[model samples]
Target: MQVKRFFAADMRQAMKLVRDELGADAAIIGNRRVAGGIELTAALDYPLQPAEPVKPNAALEAELRKTQAIIATAQARLSLPEGLTAKKDCQLFGERLDDFKNDFTGADHVANRVAEPAPEVVGPAPVAPHAYESASQDARGLDIVRSELHGLRELLETQLGSMAWSNMQQRQPNQAFLWRRLQRMGLPATVAHDLLAKVAGIAESQQAWRMLLAHFAQAVDVVRDDPMDEGGVIALVGPAGVGKTTTLSKLAARHVLQHGSQSIAIVSMDSFRIGAQEQLKTLGRILNVPIIPVGADQSLTQALAPLAQKKVVLIDTAGLPAADPAFRLQLEALASRGLRSKNYLALAATSQAQVLKAAWHSYKQCRLAGCVITKADEASTLGEVLGLAIGQRLPIAYFTDGPRIPDDLHRLRAHQLVSRAVSLQLAEEPSEDTMAAMFASFYNDLSRKVG
Candidate 1:
């Protein structure tokens, strides 16, 4: 866009020049009234310039004609402003319009009149000119009008109130005796309510402790972790005793049980763990699935070669807390290869929401696909767990109910997990003692010790 400035004796003449020269569709960037007339700035767009201007020829002439045509069209629309068009004749036209018949007449046909003065017809009787048009009384009467206006007002109010809940996400407070304490804390009600819901879920929200758990749980969001299903090399990675080995066995067992054992191979990253390979080997022996142990980075190339024919490559990684930088190093090695990768940040269901968040932070170095929750049967405050997952944007794929291999493991869904979490929260008089203990424990063990 390029701007062209035009100043003339008046705005109308300058605008006409703009249309005559620049063409129509030129955007008015700005206009201001000056002492004499007006100053106008306009913008126009044109095609890119050629390397150099062509001499007058058929092509150049054709371009000129097109440009001239566009300018002519623009000139036709440009006119003097309405204020400049005001003249005494314009005012007279409104008053003397057909002897005031059309000026303000409510009645169109003079003969078809009502005897009761026809509500002061403007054209025939010189109406007061202030009355506005309205529908005559109907069967529904004012009842319909009143109801419609009430609904319209309510709808408008609702739209404006939509913004009221913006700051209330902190979990709401309890509605009973707890409300006073909540007000004193100056906490937003939504957060208070959410915390109260968590209290309700755990049967733990008390007048005093309701806000605490709600705040904690609201701070967490647990997602139903789902691992990638794409065919390629897959690894189950997590900290020691987080059930990485068991999770591997469960997945491998399913593959072998569903497809034949010959179709799958298990590559263990933990060659150093005592009996880890042997334990997996034992499962392999029972399941009749082959287990490949990679001792070092180079060994993966050889191990992966024999399993090339396998439909799915399940790599059971060495279980190390992501706090260990070495775990990321091994993960990088797998990523170095063309193998598709996803790390399962396995978490124990009984783990505190704070601890789960810490575990997620520890595994932050790895590209975590989703979470695998274990030990869910031991805890009821799944809301805290779900909250943690949601806060981290981690999807949960599978949850292990216990030590059982295939029977205990099931993939989690978002709606199902939230529903279950809500149910647990809605359970009658959910306990708050557990929440109090957990909060105090963290404060004492972590904050106090560090401080």
Candidate 2:
């Protein structure tokens, strides 16, 4: 087999060049549009035995027919006149053709010499998929070869990624470790780098950790204390299955426990779910507080009229996808109706960092007052929630770690939340090898500073 490439101002000129040089025996393997014109890849094949009879297998006969028909159609479509003149600006094309011919014909390798094109022993033009598919043994062998090549490509890519990571680890051990730790917590690269850049000269590992924590603590916006104490209308909003209803119930329960059941009223705007209103009602019954259901057409202002005397009205909104048209429209409807509400995005701690960020971004149209982090007990790492809290500058209003109504809900504390993040790091990681030693050293440095 021999491979060659040709470039021409147009397909007609390229076909003319191919016909004059390689003749009709050359097959156009591939074509692509170039800057000035088009580029074509052509190949020729020479078989050993010329007098051998062609035996077509039953299975491959259909495929070969299809392939031959397509090739024939393409050839007919690109048919050129025999009297066509070659372009005088063929200097560039001639140079490339000569270079490819020299590279193929002048090769010193034994295999290359064997596969060299011969003038008299012209076989079928090189097909995109060779005769391997037509022969059972060759087909099976090529399948194994293709699989091995795929595995080799994956292995190479993995090796390259590892090499790049290794280089970073070697050059900036401290920074790399810190970055990886934050990333493990589900922080985006952009957020992680921004946090790292804020850290100034740190003589000790403890200081570095503390500085980062302090930065994280300061970076997070917190409502501090119970939001219900200062709340009027607080709504829990987020995507589906994020525990919005559960978090809203938890908040309502907490408000009732602190300020009594009479002053608190829980409302469900999630009429989409079959038993969503009932779920909130069940919780409302448990707390002996009024539970109201608001429909899409019903005026929220009118619904809250009876609860006007209540100190806190917690709204439970329908959980929706970020891209859902109803998601933005619901918020707009409330705003247009002059229904004032403080939206607290109920985010699950077990969610990926990007997912949590997306929730925050999507619900920002509602002008989120703060966030309620849920499913804390289910999460192995609080990094995602913590990263989200700090990165979005949205204060952590409440946390619901368990299914317990008021028992699981607690107001977020900056120092305590930061402490939990560090504790999660210690508990989740094994205290073995260099990584464990690094962690131990980090804490020991902090202990010394504390002393």
Candidate 3:
């Protein structure tokens, strides 16, 4: 019999080499893990030696028969199932052989089992490319199903909302009219719904409308006394380019005209801007008040120490992005208990509702005393800022309509703000689809609470 040895990185590779070099009929006798791979000893034509007959002793014969029976039982238990592929069958056979050797060879052999080939050396069967493609397709199909379900949910909501709105118009026409009127004024559905709830049982449309306007005006909280009149250390805080410096100048000019510039001073923490300090200096020159330019290295407490005698010290903070470390530090300084400074958020009326809201959240860390609505003359509608102030319950201290310094800054008047919002109301009614989409979630929330 011609015998040869084959070496390969894995069992499958070794088996392939054996078949290619020694042909399909070659019989594998011994296999072992070698330096970098496995070694298989295969023979083309293996010789089987016949056993000679022996004279039997009864006791010895009984012991030999019992051992043969145990060997047969173990082989039967380790046999591979017919359903498994040839590759899997080969792997299972090798594992079962190792297990059998470990069990019968005693603890010494089992302890040295680490010398045997690791299971990972054989590796798992390679998954076909089609299997991965199938899985990817399934994931894509699931995403499509989710998207369709979301669209279906929105459609159902819109239809249900249309039906509910129709019912409201038919049952309570007066309330429906007032709700539509509020919507025309550009009020969010949530705020309009809340205001509508206040005049629930009023049957007359005109009276209900009048009462709604009154309630709307009352909802906007304002400072009883103007900041210029009250005169304290006030810091104007907001995002960059919302007119902090301009608003500060306006406040200083107003205070200078009314209370004299001697009692007031301006502290600029806006050193980061290119011409910020210069602008404040120019304003200081015009108003005859001292403009204290606070550098990044200067402590706000140290800067304000000498100005303790001043009645109104307006701080014009740098309009830095909320993410900046300096922005947070400035807010922390203003919020410090010892400073006792009233921080007022400066919001631009021309900004979108979301921008206005974000500005409020960013500056609110300073314990905002109130807000100053800037750029009112440029804004097409006042509803956005009005809604923000009313929703956040932030008192409006002043409103600046123009760049005319003291001429533009006016004390907050609730009725005038409400009337301005009304005058800017949209002339055309909202489309049916628009109204349905807007009120769908609102009506659904109300139904859930009522039910």
Candidate 4:
């Protein structure tokens, strides 16, 4: 069997690449999302009919010889002085364990054993110290087991998530096609399936897509009431370099535009980076609002005491990884200090699904009320961001597609998001030939239906 891997920005394109190189008979083994796009692995069995096995080519023979030589050299190095090696030790131990198991429960022993129950005997009372020690050990063991189970559960969930798309493709091609349409835009398979399932039995492609988008729009939750309208403390939290400060500045500027700069106050908790405060301060200077810098030792409440009377207070947090120990500490400090703020995770549209998921999971500790998608102009696909929001049910607060201060920040509308996602998906299509092939197949089906 010969195997090849193809990578594309989406699944349909990946499948096209696979079909072009491996032919229609190629069996797809696996597929997954990589750094830039999706990867598909397809395999083909060389011998299609009964025949003599093909012999290896000269190049293959040479490669096999080289591989054998490398293996021999590694084996020689791993050999011990007495002929026993690490591999052999493991093999021997496994064999002994198997033998022990067989010996302990042999057929003869089962036949010779009595079936009658034995009389109960009184047992000694457990020692207090031993009982306490046993309890401690059991508690520790239970913790370890729970941790392992949790890891296993996450692994299983990821695997199951991957299978959802493929299973839908196999079971219901038409519904799966609609599902992939949403998936191509970067939505999770499970989310796409759930949406598609709602509009079942729709045969026409255009009608299906229309229904899908309409349903998608209903499912999407946008910021109905902007935090700035009736805002207290609104913090922008996300991973590093996701344009958190810029987003905060945009929101602050937007607030200033509507309700004068006097009613708004900008506070910076992003003391980790050298110029984070300066950027917000620069925006503060531009908007004519005070940018209060809160130090590590300073209390957030104390820092914002003067701004208590302000209509809106936008807090800019340090863009740190969710897994960082410091992130939890920051959350703890915010909670302990009674920094009641409506947190909004600043996610970039250019981020992959996993990266967005990580950001969502991490900043969720802040009790994020919603998300604000930034860098929309820079992002080639909005599907990943949209999918993250829909899957997590995170309402989108605002969208900043460009760098324009208050101008670029627009309210999140469901129709606009769906349109952008579809446009991006269509824009990423492969070359003319691939598109022609797809259209030709569609034409043939239409012609047959007419006849």
On lDDT, the candidate that comes out on top is 3
Writing each residue's lDDT as its tens digit, candidate 1 over 1-451 gives: 8789888654445666789778997866656556765677788984445566423234323433443443343233222233321122122222222222221132212112321233444565553544222222221223333333333222222221221121111232233334333333322333344454444433333634644544544454344323334456777766677678887788887777676787777888886687788889899899988888886656566678878887777788776655677677776766553655666677876776557777788676567777777777766656555655655777677877777777777875555554455455423432242232222232223322333
lDDT of each: 0.54, 0.64, 0.74, 0.67
lDDT of 3 by residue, 44-90 (tens): 99886686664333433343344344445534533434343322322
**Higher lDDT: candidate 1 or 3?**
3
Deviating ranges (above 4 Å) for candidate 4: 1-173, 428-451
Candidate 2 Cα RMSD after full superposition onto the native fold (Å): 20.1
Q: How far is candidate 1 from the true structure (C-alpha RMSD, Å)?
A: 27.6
The sequence of per-residue lDDT tens digits that candidate 2 reaches over residues 320-423 is: 66577877777775554366788888889889876887877777877777888889888878877877777678888887789987698877678778777766
- Whole-model lDDT, candidate 3? 0.74
Model 4, range 186-205, lDDT digits (tens) per residue?
66644665677677778786
Candidates in order, TM-scores: namely: 0.46, 0.58, 0.69, 0.60
What lDDT does model 1 reach? 0.54
Clash-forming residue pairs, model 3: none
List the RMSD of every prediction in angstroms.
27.6, 20.1, 24.9, 18.6
On a 0 to 100 scale, what is the lDDT of residue 202 in model 2? 61
